[model samples]
Target: MLRLISSIIFRLLFYRFPQLAYSQEEIEEYEKMYSKALTSKSEIKYSSNFPKLHFIQYIASTKKVVLHGSNHKGINEFEPRRQTLFNGKYEEAVFATRDGIWPIFYAVFDRNKLVGNFRNACISSDLKYNYYFFSLTRETILSNPWTSGMLYFLPEETFEKVNHSLVPFDEWISKSPVAPLTKIEVEPEDFYFINKVSYHNPKESVIVSWFLYKLRTKFFIKR
Candidate 1:
């Protein structure tokens, strides 16, 4: 049949021209080149001069939080709305807050010191005895190479460099529930670099991650 003749001719041609058969190394090289070409098409290049950011982890205690009024000083009960208590335990509660809560005084950690900021602080969850400061964006984590197991605090410079159309920090604050702003004195020693092996991955926007995955899938695979 014609099919059999074509198959025989194809084999004979390949046998006559051994170069038609690629070696393992040659096939691997071709794949590498193809992947490089595909990646380069949409690859984002960050500046080498971009300053590296550090992650901040605060280790807290269960001791009652004490706040002082103008003339009165007393132990304050954790706000029920701001915290979540275990099934029956009242003393233990998680102090979790969203990315941008405006009019909120945040204790910023810059290397060795805990600085104060009215806004633009990267503070994350408020779980018992552990306060997280670095939050990763869906776009940055999935696309950017620098983002790793250790959540990189979205520094102002880095934030500006990347695309912000997904979830802008200001957008969150605009929709956030109004809360009274109060300055809290946080000790420098209270925070330290959280061990990545133990620290959990920083939460990212689910919607954003889904959207990016859908867009990048074409570049990643061909149907």
Candidate 2:
């Protein structure tokens, strides 16, 4: 009975989030990069290229690129870390991507640190593609106002490059660790949100899902 249930769950997951098949060569490369990054003892510092910035959220499905409270606006409130940034200190950044939902990826950081350089590499949950290595300094954060939270959507074309450059932020932070490493576990609900945001075929499915409609209307729909 347990085996049967396990099989059913596996099938359901596969159906909902199809596994991406990567070549053996690609898999080997990611493993190599991940191993090297994990074992490296080199000092990782934040790059000077990143500007001092902070963001509340991002909306890519619109015309005007709106950055809600970005560009070092909240740095004052983000004290201690804020001082570090001003002192030219760099925060370590780690990257990861989910399977089934290919494009929605994440770059977790050691508390208070933003993305460092753009040459580091990290591993992926799927082990299919790696994470992108990009600096998330004030300039990049202000320039690229993306939807907030752990969830992010990037173009399909850039997926490969992003994955190859995945650097483990936690690994770097471990050198002179200040905070605990964050392990982000993507939930099923997150997958649903990514799908709704990234691939919305209004003809095939309703743009405003039932849950969203309820949330939007708040039980005040008139007959």
Candidate 3:
């Protein structure tokens, strides 16, 4: 059983990280890069040199296709996460996140052009008993928005035990060592809102989703 479990875990890690396929000497180089990344500031380079920003925005543009009442996922999720949660928009769209690591985004579109996007992330629920965390979010723009901008978040605990796992906000806080880390605080599960916001209208949908890789906090986009 132990060998089987080990093999499965090893395969999963290898599948997620190409670096694991390298030799030990190469591993040391990766470690150096990781250490540098640890010290580097948290930022997404917006210049042409950084492909992530463009990719994320591109996804947002595509998301506007079915943004209206067609694939209306945000309509379904607003009840639970709202009235207690928060949201963020990429341009003009407003948004919020849901429980269970499920990512939801809303955007607005007009004449096949994206006008606004709302990107939201949620940190809700504490599964001390089940040992897992979950979240969901959706964004819709008043202009041209994707029919649905879908992103998924993994369990927060996965970041530590698995180096290849997506990093949660907790990881960044760990690196910076905030004063709140002294004691773990799990918010009440009574459908409390985590993060929510609404933005003004936009002339075009200038939002996109880059690679949903976890640097420290969960990141994603729909293109």
Candidate number of the best TM-score: 2
Report the lDDT tens digits of candidate 1 across residue range 1-223: 6544544433322111011333465445444533453355422122222111110111001111211111111212223233212122232221323222111222322222222211121211112111212323223223321211111111121111111232211211111222222222222222232111011123534333333332333343211
Which residue pairs does candidate 1 place in steric collision? none
Candidate lDDT scores, in order, read 0.23, 0.25, 0.24
Which digits, one per residue and each the tens of the lDDT, describe model 3 over residues 1-223? 6544544433322112011133455445433432343356222222233222123323222221111111222222211112212212122222222122222222211114433333333221122210112112233322223332222211121122112122221111011111110111011121111221223233323122211212112332332
Off by over 4 Å in 2: 1-15, 41-195, 198-223
Candidate 3 backbone overlaps, count: 53
lDDT, candidate 3, at 87: 18
Which portions of model 3 miss their true places by more than 4 Å?
1-98, 106-119, 123-140, 148-197, 201-223
Model 1, C-alpha of 152: deviation from truth (Å)? 22
